[model samples]
Target: MASARLERGVVVGARLLVAAVFVAAAVPKILDPAGFAAAIRNYQAFPYWSWNGLAVGVPMLEVVGALALLSGWKRQAGALLLGGLTLAFVALITSVIVRGIDIGCGCFGQSEAAESVGWPLLVRDLGLLAAIVVAAREPGPLRAARVR
Candidate 1:
């Protein structure tokens, strides 16, 4: 019973942590989309026409996924979306590093002092992916022990 209780606590913690991250990342972008759009443009990954669409959509997606994670019934779906987004971020960051395009990662918003994409950011995103995975998979119900 104690173990099961601990597991439940950990899972809930993971979900809250992941949701918090998404909300933090989403808010700045949601407020200042044009700057975020410029940050997307700096990536040079997507076409010029798509930048505006991505700028608008990505923050909304983050908020929606975060909300879902907060809702017990929709947690799995939320985790899946957040996990996929994290993976995509990892890939995108890796691509930037490989191509040697040094620029601030437009993750939290288009701040002048934003951190640049590098191995550190990739590792962070990977950590987030792991947390998302944990949040998505809740432990099975505990069974009672029987004695002879």
Candidate 2:
């Protein structure tokens, strides 16, 4: 019983962590779409024409997914969305490193001092992905075991 309770706690904690990450990542992009678009363009993963759309769309998705995770309704779906986004980020970051392109991660926001893409960023994204996967595997909040 205690083990179950502990597992539930871990799941809830992971969910909240992932939710916070998504929300944090989304807000800056939403607030400054043009800057975010430039950041996306720096990646060179997508065409210039698509930057604006992606800049707007990605942040919106992050907000919606984060809200869903926090609300405990459709949490699994949110986790899946976050997981996919994290995977894409890891891939993009990896590509930039492999290609020797020095650019901001464009993850948190579009700041002039945004951190450059590197292995640390890739590891962080992978960690978030792991958290999402763990949270997604658990039952919903109400079904989680409660410790005395």
Candidate 3:
């Protein structure tokens, strides 16, 4: 019984930690929509007009996902969305690395930085991907083990 309780606590802690990271990342983009648009443009992921839409929309979705995870509301859906988002980010960063594109990650920044793409960014996203996958799959001991 004690061991199960400990495991449940650990799982919840992991989910909270991942949720917190997403929330923190969203704050800066929320503060400067225009800057985030420019950052999205820097990725060259979409057409000119679409960049603005993506800039505005992506962060908002992220905020929603973060809130869902934090609140443990519709946790399974939230975790799935978070996992999908993390996978998309991983793919984007991988493409940038492959194409030898030296640009600011702009993940935390509203605008580009005067730095080059490197292994660290990929590594970070990979870590997040792992966390998202774990959270999605497990959804914590308490939630999973409870009577349905």
Candidate 4:
């Protein structure tokens, strides 16, 4: 019984943490899409035209998915979206590193204090992936644990 409680505690903690990070990251970009667009341009991952649209859309999607995860109403869908975003970021950052591109991650939007793309950033994202993987592997619906 103790073990079960411990595991559930861990799952709840992970979901809260992941949701917090996504919400924090999304808010800045949502507030400053022009800055985000400039940062995306630095990565040169997508076409020039798509950068603006992505900057506008990605943060909104992040918030929606995060809220879903936090609320446990559509946890699976949220996990899928967040997992996909995390995976895509890993790939994008890896490509940037391979090409010797020196740029901030723009993870929390473009800022003087933005984290640069590097192995550390990759590791952090990987940790988030692992957390999401754990959440995804839960045996039943998360709504069971959701507070009324």
Candidate 2 lDDT over residue span 1-148, tens digit each: 6666677788888888888889999999999999999999999899889999999999999999888887878977887787788888989999999999999988989887899999988888888888888878665443643422
lDDT of 1 at 48: 98
lDDT of 3 by residue, 2-99 (tens): 66678666667768778888887788878887887877777776689898787777777787887887687887788778878888888888888888
Local accuracy of candidate 4 as per-residue lDDT tens digits, 11-130: 888888999999999999999999999999999889999999999999998999889888887899999999999999999989998999999999999889999999999999999999
CA lDDT, every model vs. true structure: 0.88, 0.87, 0.75, 0.89
Query: Could you tell me how far off, in angstroms, the CA of residue 18 lies in candidate 4 after the best superposition?
Result: 0.2
Q: Candidate 1 on 1-148: residue-level lDDT in tens?
A: 6787677778889989999999999999999999899999998899999999999999998998988987876878888888888988998999999999999998999887899999999999999999888888766644332221
TM-score of each: 0.92, 0.91, 0.85, 0.92
Q: Weakest 10 consecutive residues, lDDT, candidate 2?
A: 139-148
The runs of at least 3 residues in candidate 1 whose Cα sits more than 4 Å from the true structure, single-residue gaps closed, are: 142-148
Q: Which is the winner by lDDT between candidate 3 and candidate 4?
A: 4
Which consecutive 10 residues in model 3 have the weakest lDDT in total? Answer: 109-118
lDDT for 109 in candidate 3 is 57
- Root-mean-square deviation (CA) per prediction: 2.9, 2.4, 2.9, 3.2
Q: Which one wins by TM-score: 2 or 4?
A: 4
